[model samples]
Target: MTETTHNTVTDERADLLETLAKHRQFLRFTTQDLTDEQAGQRTTASELCLGGLIKHVTSTERNWANFIEKGTSVMPDFASMTEEDFARRADDFRMLPGDTLEAVLAEYAEVARRTDELVAALPDFNASHPLPKAPWFEPGARWSARRVLLHIIAETAQHAGHADIIRESLDGQKSMG
Candidate 1:
């Protein structure tokens, strides 16, 4: 490849990483100055809470990044799940007992670090991966690595907005001006 083309791609990757980082900063800002109880409180009618949003996004990004790294998936054993297991899965969007904002934030940082490292080390952004056999996805759809990164950015941006609203309801605070 030409030097100019290489530079352009590097610039684009940096821009994408910067955009994701900015959204993540907003999400973190929303949780600032909040206690564990406050972070877990359902300030609005929606089931979403600050702590839960952080956990959800962290897990979602990490899982997708892992899929990109590994071409195939080992689907979860839903059939063998007990009633309690199902209940816990249902509550994955919630901050149950023992959940803390500090822990969630720390885990999220680790996820971000791992994802950034993976992205930097990737040779081709156009590499393709087969769609996992999940009921929620179409049968034969495939996604390129670039698409996965874009999806992660979109998910983070969307959840950042959600976190802003939740934070506003908490104490009339806004994540941004």
Candidate 2:
């Protein structure tokens, strides 16, 4: 019984690590094995591309880590953010001429590390923070910090799936193992 219980606990922790690792892998997939032009190219008519997605994710991490966790009112500017900005970022897309896959991948890894650190340090998953209670959320609904983390994770995974399809279409690259 003791051995079984220990194994179950270890399995749960491993599962969490795996989930976080998957998110990190997706960021790498979006940034790696692509040219500056190729990274910025969009398959769909919309502005979505691997580079753009990376930029989006970077900005999201900043918001989550800085504003949400650290209690800062400042947020990144989404409207003026360009492909150059996204391409330069390992996790975020910036469309500068010299932006390389290496830079973007490095940044993505860093962002993932920071995010993991913050999430792991949370005292209570159920602890309610202020943002969800702001005017943005529905009147009767208040969101806990945990809900935000889960939502971001879900959103990242969804976009990572999109990035994989787009990247594959762009260069016949397989994003998953």
Candidate 3:
């Protein structure tokens, strides 16, 4: 390949890594102020907590990676789940019973690592992958793996914003980076 192409690739990779890093920064910022109970507390009538958001984001990363990017789905076990399921399960977002806060944090850290690995390993940002035929997304829309990564970033960002708000409401603190 030409030197120009190599430079372009490097630049692209840098931007992707930077974007992912920012997401991690926010995730850390959001959870940093919370105590164990606060982190797991449901802030609103709707089931949303800092811990829940963290769990949701991790699950989403793995879901997108496995079902969309890697083409090996694990949705069947969760196929019966719906929006309500999420709302109810939000309270259970923390690590299983007897699990420590460190364990949950480690799990999320691994999720972020896997996300980074997927992004870094993609040689071509333009390559397409099958997206679920969900109503919210365009029908039969084949998304580039790059787009999927970006979408995850965007979704996490939105939730991070919510987490920041909820965290502040729980206490006087605000701004998740």
Candidate 4:
């Protein structure tokens, strides 16, 4: 069993995972009681929707987890990406046809499960990997496993806030409340 000291790597990992779990629940709470059609509705002027945000976070976290396990992340080829490809990619955050709330949530749950297992099995939190080449990322930047986990927690919290707003706008329900 892992030790549970406040500043230990095990403690930090446990805290991050707990925060991720809470925020993930907040995200799911936002979609609670909403029909699939309502979930896809754009309550705000922004393109983001509750279901889509959930889907996006799930995809983003899975990619980051994979990056941590391996040395690099698998990304789509933007150079070869046609306009059609880009448009289709946009569907990640938009509840398109055939995208149901249950299906998306199930997929997100599976991703989270895999991520948790990977984090638990990590040999060292300080282990580092060079980030993949991407214009959005700083050049030659690398992140330790601990940092990557923190990044995932941050991403989840930020998206949870976005989801809270969208959820509040819909039927005047707040996730926090």
Candidate 5:
């Protein structure tokens, strides 16, 4: 039996949200006490930075949440992206000029709040839509809102691990022991 709260989420939804929150906290903890420069600095061979990870996760969550409501129209046709499009996407992995840690974190918080509200208010987890046409996605494949939430959780957890590594490299800090 699933319990509902004032926000009206089922027990399953609450579990999903709790897991997502834990990962988000781990990711955000990696950037604590860091300056913008430090946040943006790439600490490893890969082009990932703490601030960029936060930005990328925020964008990803926003897009997926939009997909839950609007379907494939919310996603870009990755198969047809041009050089400029690719370049712009690459920017999601870097801290561009004038990008502030504070602003990035603020945006992520807003996106997260929206996603949490969306999850709470969702009428059904089984509602699904065909995936946008992309090379990586199988043809005719569809994903339910529940699946999308799981994907988001996986993405956040994966990147949080990456952020932990980057943060450890940047400084002596660890998100966990």
Candidate 6:
């Protein structure tokens, strides 16, 4: 078992947490030394920005963590989402006024902590829940808590790559040489 400050986690849980944490660090590294404007600036043709990527990943992790705990009730009804809903979702990729890089990082850190805590404390990784009704998901599909953790790790890693590209474009500073 992996010993955490608040709880002991099984080896599987520890591995999951370690992988997610590594990706989260990579994502956050891209934002280092960036001001709010720099973080929000679109470095490429895509609408994604460094700060926005962090915000998006933070939101995604939080939602998925909630799903692991509370199931589909925590997810939005994507099938019935309005244009306004989509627009609001799009805002997650932008750093609006009053958004600071510090605050965004702080929020992401807090979310990660909560997710780690939940994962460590969960008694059964095999417990499963039906996915929310969404076109992308197979009908009657179910995902175990283990699956949800894996999904969060994949999502974070993908966005970290995106953030690395954005960072390189922004200032020619690569996350790795």
**lDDT per residue as tens, model 1, 78-102:** 4466788777765657888999999
lDDT of all the models against the reference? 0.84, 0.63, 0.68, 0.85, 0.94, 0.92
1-177 in candidate 4: lDDT tens per residue? 543333344766778788889988988899999899999999999999999999999988988888888777464544567889988878889998999999999999999999987787777777898877666778889999889988989999899999999988888898865
Give the per-residue Cα lDDT of candidate 3 at 98: 62
In every candidate, how many clashes are there?
0, 17, 0, 0, 0, 0
lDDT score at residue 62, model 4, on the 0-100 scale: 89
Candidate 6 residue lDDT tens string, 71-113: 9999988989999999999878899999999999999999999
Which parts of model 6 have CA positions greater than 4 angstroms off? Answer: 1-6
List runs of model 1 lying over 4 Å from the truth: 2-9, 74-86
State candidate 1's TM-score.
0.87
Root-mean-square deviation of candidate 6 = 2.2
Q: What lDDT score is found at residue 16 in candidate 2?
A: 55
Candidate 6 matches the true fold with a TM-score of 0.95
Record all residue pairs in model 6 with backbone atoms less than 3 Å apart, i.e. clashing. Answer: none
Candidate achieving the largest lDDT = 5
Ranking by lDDT: 5, 6, 4, 1, 3, 2
Record all residue pairs in model 3 with backbone atoms less than 3 Å apart, i.e. clashing.
Answer: none
| Estimated TM-score for each candidate | 0.87, 0.69, 0.78, 0.89, 0.96, 0.95
Ten consecutive residues with minimal summed lDDT in candidate 3? 1-10
lDDT of 2: 0.63
Poorest 10 consecutive residues by lDDT, candidate 4: 1-10
Arrange candidates by TM-score, descending: 5, 6, 4, 1, 3, 2
Which residue pairs in candidate 5 collide?
Answer: none
